[model samples]
Target: MHSEVAQLFRYSLGFIAAISFVACLCIIALAQVFPWLCGRRDDENAVQSMHSRPTPRIGGVAIFFTLALGVVFAPTTIVQSYLGVIIATTLLFLVGLSEDLGFRVSPRRRLLAVCVASLVVIVLLGVWLPRISMPYFDLLMQYWIVGVPFTLLITAGVANGFNLIDGVNGLAALTAIGASVSIALISLQAGYDTMAMVSMMLAAVIFGFFLVNFPFGIIFLGDAGAYTIGFVLSWFGIAVLIDSSQVSAWAILLTLFWPLADTVFAIYRRSRSKKDAMAPDRLHFHQLVMRGLEICILGRKRRRIANPLTTLVLAPFVIAPQVCGVLLWDHNRAAFFTVLAFLAVFIASYLVAVPAIRACRQRPQEA
Candidate 1:
């Protein structure tokens, strides 16, 4: 126990120092370079939120490189064990960077690129979802056919989901930090030193990004940053689940609940509205919540504060599942049931809140 505590203390210091230094340097460099690197925001796409101007959307470039630097300099003995994950995540980052830099990469092409990256991770690293918590599902996943595709689907889904949730300033980065910290704790408690170190490193790097992103919105965590974060977290969650028997599947589910739930909700809502699932809209959960705050909370007098304030407001709720996951990490049955109940409550709240906000917005004109 003494040695374990010592190791964790050592890792914590190195993780914070390395990531913090790299993030600072990278952010300074990107602040100078992003104007040349990123194109003007294409608000016609309905993806860019209202801001003072078309700020740089290539903040992901800084985060990606800084995170890589932190990993290369990590105090862990098994840093090289993450080579496959790092490479695959870099590939996704490049694809996202290309899109941000005005490349006309279609949604299908981008999705395919993410899938290709996930395939490389699976083929090279052998990190795939082997089992879910349910006995029947776990049995089915024992077959290679079921397991391989299922793993690929989840990896890609998360990669895309990160991009989907990046519409709001600081939202994706804050959510990533919350989830990463939770997973790091879970891995640490399970004695997976490498996974714990890496997750904490990720959380620290993103928190550095968050410092500039929140309240003022000086920069954005573009597709590269968002996709890379999602890939890393998803990979880490899978690694912990596969390597540790003590960690319940519900822990992984809860770690990823917000992004996955948001993506699934968007797809279903779009399909019902006869729009393409990947089509951009301004009515996401975050967007609606912000709008609600704008109407009921901020009022017209404080409208400008809504964007940043909304991120702060929703961050705790985003992190709530991960907190629950950590507390129930050892109890699989209890964790699974709790997640189900929380998810149901969350959906109900979303349904009620969104329409209520819409009605609030319309009432003045109706009156």
Candidate 2:
């Protein structure tokens, strides 16, 4: 733990994080000065948009821009070990950024981009899920054939998952902050200084974006920001697990459970309706909560208030699973059960509370 703290303050990492924070603030300020140049601006017209006015959505550029600078300042060995991943995530972010810039990138193409990035990272870094904590699966996972494809699928799914949950103002950024810190804390506990630093650096970079995003919604996470967050964090989970066999993959998954859960639920919901799984919709957990607040208490015209409020209401839901995961980082059996328990709660909230609110919203207003 002492080493973790030292590493945090040493190797110019603290300076890099501080610089990244200012860098994000600069991006926000620049966007305000020249909004037209900052990719696309979003309003309430799109199916998934929650904001009332058009806002610049290319905040990912600032994040990766700062992240690359951090890599340059990192120790040579750390950069050598992670350069391939940084490249992969850069490509992934650019592909999503193109979409954010009002280009014609489809969801299919975006998913394909993630798959390509995952393959490069896996091949270059040799990162794969060694075991799944299950018996037969563990035996199968030991082989690259099973592990490689499984890792690829999961990495792509998670990259897209972050995109799915970027509904409310602070939901994605805050959830990313909480999960990254959890990963860093667990990495510190396991004496993996590199992993801890990477995780903490990520948390710091995202926090800079969070300051202007929450409550006021001056800027947005956009496709690039959301996808990059998922891409990096999901791979960070794999990287840490490979670095230390003691770390539970289930625990790692728990750290990312909030967005991943929403993605899985989205796939299931879309499948039930015979729609393409990648098709966009407004039935997301955060979306439901936003609508609920508008219909029940805040009233529909109060969206400016309800949007960020939805993030606050669900922030605990994001943090709790991460805390549980970090606390049980090395306990596979406990973490596995804890994952199942959280899923139960997640699904119940989706099926019960959301539908109840949907019914309430559908009723005719009294004359």
Candidate 3:
């Protein structure tokens, strides 16, 4: 691998971005012009619904379609380089697309699809989670039995984690932009040129989707977009760790801290109540922040104001670890402890914020 990203790839970056941005606009325009044939529009009535309008939820189609076009028009060398990894994820993306198109795809089946995707990547791309600098545990990862499952665990966890956090406008997409840029910087610093270029292109894809998703919520990312972004980012982390002897796994973990933290918290919070782990709820950290904004400041009637505002409010907290992770990519001990410190703050904030907002909303009714 060259330390310098190919000049062709550098030029193709803008092309990749332009296609994604245009593709998303086309999807939205088509939905407006032909509503009956425009796939599925969200009802926004779930326990976690945040918007009031029925919006197209098939942004993934535009994203993947953009990627397909990139393979043909963009630099073929750059596109072919990551082709296998891209093909492996088709299963996970299609499973998610099924759900987005109002078809039933069970959680169990989705997990199975991602696990299969992980296995394919492990075999085809030769990418898997490498050493974490953990003493005994790091040694165990050398074996196929332990290593393969660890890879699958990470793959499935991140895919589902991003899906869970895709509740509010621009929430998932913005965090993805933050994470993708972080990964690209770290990959560039570590001399993984291919990974860096792909990471940048992924950021471009999400930016296209974000233009319509944020502030007003013209189209929802739905499950497909979230899963694809999460799966891609997680594997990017794994591939970077495998390629760079200097990059710390803990640093990658820090880059991905927001979604993983929220997912683990949601599981804990739900399990404590003896509820299904896969069941949807409004207890996610992002949701709590959105609700707090509505209750204390924006009020219930100002959803259009509060919806995207919540993403802006939480953006810094979500972006900090990603920036910090890039800075500490080579410092194993520092990155490890930083991840712990972040997890502590995130959990503590959620615990305090959720209840205080609950009480604030309840007090008016009690009055």
Candidate 4:
């Protein structure tokens, strides 16, 4: 029986992997043909004026289709477990596509869309953070009212975090790809086959998108892509924790520290500046890297670097320690404290570096 079960699991994984890869390729091909059909050319001036050209921002459409197909074709267990996630993700993709295509959707309207999607997933699908280790209390009371609201907040926050971080080439997509793979591996180890399969599908599609997004930027994930990725990842994270007996809720938090940290910092920064919290700005860590690279290159400094290098050097530094802490520490309290400490250090470093980076960009170049 044991051997048979092991073989079945292996076959399931292999089948899902093949399907995901093929779906990803199809999505890429469809995305490549979409811009011409829509009478949109790559925006040359936008590329020059901004960081990347206006490629067909509808790559999310491909991602959405592929992911849906992958999920629908997956094994019975995975399909049954992830049905709610699929529905929620589709709703978010629609919202994102509308925003991408010049729909006059306000932030409030977009947020409401997210809320509705999250509520459906939470209420009907029953996805949530089912457990958390409270330091003093023996067991945290599982209140439906409180849990529902909290889950909605997390889902909405994750969606916005991905959207907010999509300012640079390969930044958001690459991060999603990496994090999704990691989560999939962890879920596999924990014997959560359904969660693992969903993560694998997402990772595969995002990896294909990354090929066009990185180095020479040929496409952008836009709002649709970001929303889908965020919704799925957030749902996967919650599913893993809820299904596991050994894993703490803190593990999910630690794994996703970078984007969560950025979201919190952005809110605080905006509040401090007395600016509208929803207004966009170029003050993100990735934006800072871009500014630093442009300054270094134009200054003709002996030490010059590319924009990608800035992301490469900084993102891992922020993410690695938290992942290690989560994996190494068994106690939830210890892990939670460790994550909080890391967040404090990251925020402090950002505060110190932001001023210097801005000054470097604003400095007059040699005549």
Give the candidates in order of TM-score, highest first: 2, 3, 1, 4
TM-score of 2: 0.94
In the range 42-114, model 2's lDDT, one tens digit per residue, is 4457787777676778778777886776676554556865678788888889898888778868999999999
Question: Which residue pairs in candidate 1 collide?
Answer: none
Q: Write the per-residue lDDT of candidate 1 for residues 175-207, one digit (tens) a residue.
A: 888888899889878888767767877887787
Clash tally for model 1: 0
What is the TM-score of each predicted model, taking all chains together?
Answer: 0.90, 0.94, 0.93, 0.83
Candidate 1: residue 32 lDDT (0-100):
71
**Please, what is the whole-model Cα lDDT of each candidate in the order they appear?**
0.77, 0.83, 0.82, 0.67
**Reference-based lDDT, residue 50, model 1:** 50
The residue ranges of model 3 lying beyond 4 angstroms of the native Cα positions read 1-10, 33-42, 72-81, 365-367
Model 3 lDDT per residue over 125-222, tens place: 66578876677998999888888899899878888888888888898999998999899899989977777877877887788778778878888787
The residue pairs in collision within model 2 are none
Give the candidate number with the greatest TM-score. 2
Clashes of each: 0, 0, 0, 0
Highest lDDT model number: 2
The ten-residue window of minimal lDDT in model 1 covers 36-45
Worst 10-residue lDDT window for candidate 2 reads 35-44
- Residue 155 Cα positional deviation in candidate 1, in Å, after optimal superposition: 1.3
